[model samples]
Target: MEQIIANGLYLGAQYALIALGLTLIFSLMNVLNFAHGQMYVFGGFVTYTVVVQLGLPFVVGLFASALALAVMGAAIEKFLFAPVVRRSKRDESTMLLAAGVAFFLDAVILLFFGEKQRGVPKVVNGVFNWDMRIIMPYDRILIGVLAVLLIVAFIVFMNYSRSGRAMRALAQDRTAAQLMGVDVSRYSMLGFALGAMLAGLVGGLLVTITGVNLGMGGPTSIKAFLMIMIGGAGVISGAIAGGFILGMMESVGLTVLSAYGDITYLAIFASLMVFLAVRPQGLMGKPWG
Candidate 1:
């Protein structure tokens, strides 16, 4: 039971990290990036390629993965999506554009990395036990700590920094922000890049505990999509809250109802159904005035 709780908390934190990036993208840009999970996988690949393949320091790969994705995100926004947004008559086209990119990227991943799962070398190893009852591994502890610190840092950035303020302003009211001299194109690109960087960092980090493979992007993207839906599409707080909630649900469901292992999805689906029926706006989505 104790281990279950610990695992659930860690999973919740990790999910929240991914959800945070996803929600930020939606909040900053009206486009829903269906290709985010690939970026996540790419991040791990970058780490694996660097640290494992090239024999560099793990930390270098850790940050390099983020930088690589950040650049890719900016390029995607600038060249791919922005061009479509400029000429298109509707925002709906963005979805198709994103979907197209996702499929293309997925194919690219398969071609380059193949279907094999690659394990990340542990950043740190060993386990810790508390009074012979509660036990925690160092790797899990590292993940949880890093996730929390990163999340806190992100929140601080969004709240206190100048660029962060600009993001918040845009998320709140794009027209007003633009009218006040905010550069829409620059910040929009930055928002997308930052979101991708977050996902990539998680990619590198997750590999410390789990193996990375090509198909990871799809399930991860699904969970993120579900997370934001539960939290409300454009609400950052909603994403965080929803992530933790789903994490606990998955943990408890798997632990207690192992026989009905599908309980995680079943519970999520049931909640989604109820939310759609009663309050489709999401837990933290603001009701329009």
Candidate 2:
């Protein structure tokens, strides 16, 4: 039980960060960024290259991943999404564009990084065992703590920073924010970049544990969608709640259903479907008109 709780908390922290990015983009532009998972994969590859191929420190690689993804995200917003949003008459076009970008990134990752799984050396060695009931690797503990710190930092920024406030205003009401002298376009791009940065950061952090591969993107995106769906679409708090809930469910299912093999995920999805049928708007979402 103790090990399960520890595992759930670790996974939840990382999952929450991933969901936060996706939710931010949705709240701001109403665009479901299918490329988000690709962005994460791209970040992982960048870190792997820096740390493994280029012999850089893990910290440097992590920052490089975040910065690279941030630039890519801002460019995508400026060049692809923003133009399509302005010129296209339907939201479907943006969705298609996002899908195209996801495919493009997948190709790019495959070409540059190859299909082989890649991982960084552990930043720390050894395990932390408490009463033989809670055994966790030190590296996982480090990553988990860092993930929590990043989440807290994100919360602080959203509440106190100028850019964060501007983005929040834009997300809350674009027309009203514009009327209040907020630069909608600028903030929108910034928000997208921030979202991508969070995804990249998590990708880098998890590379040591999960050993990223080209095929991980789609499944990661699906998990993220499940999280947002469970919590409430476009709600920040909802994303966090959904992530933790899903994490705990996964931990419990993995432990209790080990004899059943892959049925754990099937059970989880079935449960989620039932739950969503009862509350389609999610835990904190308002009913769609």
Candidate 3:
């Protein structure tokens, strides 16, 4: 149980970061970015390239990943999503565009990063074993701590910073925000960029532990969607709650059901379905129209 809890907390911290990005984008633009997972993979590859291929420090690679993804996200919002949202009457148009962008990103990743799994050297050595009950890698501990710190920073920013306040305003009520003198376009783009940056940062951090692969994008995106749904689609706190909930479920299922083959996920999905049937709006979300 100690091991399970430790593993769950560690995984939850990182997973929450991923969900935060997705939820932020959804809250701001009402656009589900299918390409988010691809962006994460791209960040991992960027980090791998910088650290492994270029012999740069891990810190440099991490920042590079964040910066690159931020630029890409902002450009995508400016050129693709914004225009589509402006011109289209139906919401499905943005969804289709998101799907198309996901495919395009997949192709781009395959072409540039190839199909191999890429990993980095351990950022820290040794394991922390406490009373032979909880054993965790030092690198994992560091990653978890960093993830938590980043999350705290993000919360602070959203609650305190000018851009963050603007983004939150936009998310709450677009028309009201605009009427209050908020530049909707600029803030929307900024919010999207920040979300993408978080994804890239988490990817870079996790590369040392899970490695980077071209095929993980779809699964990652699916997991992100699940987190958002579990917590409530457009709520930040809900996203965090959903991420930790999923992480705990994953940890327990993986550990307890190790002897049961792949039934772990089957059980999980079934449970989630039942839960959603009971509370469709999630723990903190408003009911859908």
Candidate 4:
């Protein structure tokens, strides 16, 4: 049970990291970026190519993966999202555009990578043994530590940095932010890039733990969506809360009913429904005024 709880916390950390990025983008742009998952996949591929294929150092590969995805995120914001913002269309249009990008990217990846599950080489190796009875991978511990560091960095950036303040302003009210000379479009692009970079970092971390493949993106996106929904659309802290809760539920569910493992989704959906019934605006979300 202790080991299970540790594993759950590790998984929750990853989910929280991914969900944080998604939640930030959704809050600022009001768009569920379907292509975000592809960026995650791309990050893994970047690291794989750099370290595994090209024989580069792990840290180099990691940074390269993050930088590449950050550039892609910037491009996505500028070319795809910026046009939609310029047209001032409904929120649905942005979702549609994201879906279209998702489909296109998936097809491209399928054509190139085919269907293969490949694992990233572990950067750190060991096992933590407690009382000479329980053992767990040090890599998972590293993941949890990294997640905490990233979350702290995100919070600090959002609260202290100029660009972060602009992002917060835009998230609250775009028109008002623009009137205050915040350069809304620029800030939006920055937010998207930041979000994508975080996703890429998570992707790199995930590859070390779970391997890489094309199909993983879709399921990850679904999980991220659930996190966002359960966390509340616009709340940063909500993402972490929802992710930990969902991760614990999933881990506990799997342990208790390993044979009926597929029922986790039903449990998640029920929880969401219950949460909505009681707190329509989500745990941290502001009530409709």
Across 127-161, the per-residue lDDT of candidate 2 in tens digits comes to 99999999999999999999999999998999899
RMSD of each: 1.5, 1.0, 0.9, 1.7
Model 2: residues with Cα > 4 Å off, grouped in runs = none
Q: For residues 7-93, write the lDDT of model 1, one tens digit per residue.
A: 788888999989999899888878887998888998888888888888998889889989999998999989998899889999889
Which residue ranges in model 4 land beyond 4 Å of their true spot?
132-134, 259-261
Give the 10-residue window scoring lowest on summed lDDT in candidate 4: 280-289
What's the CA error at residue 273 for candidate 2, in Å? 1.3
Residue 224 CA displacement from its true place in model 1, Å: 0.1
What clash pairs does model 2 have? none
Root-mean-square deviation of Cα positions for candidate 1 versus the true structure, in angstroms: 1.5
Candidate 2's C-alpha lDDT? 0.92
Stretches > 4 Å off in candidate 3:
none
User: Comparing 1 and 4 by lDDT, which wins?
Assistant: 1
lDDT of candidate 4 vs native? 0.84
What are the lDDT scores of the predictions, listed in order?
0.87, 0.92, 0.93, 0.84
Candidate 1: residue pairs that collide: none
True-vs-predicted CA distance for residue 121, candidate 1, Å: 1.6
Instruction: Write down the worst ten-residue block by lDDT for model 2.
Output: 280-289
Q: Supply the global lDDT for candidate 3.
A: 0.93
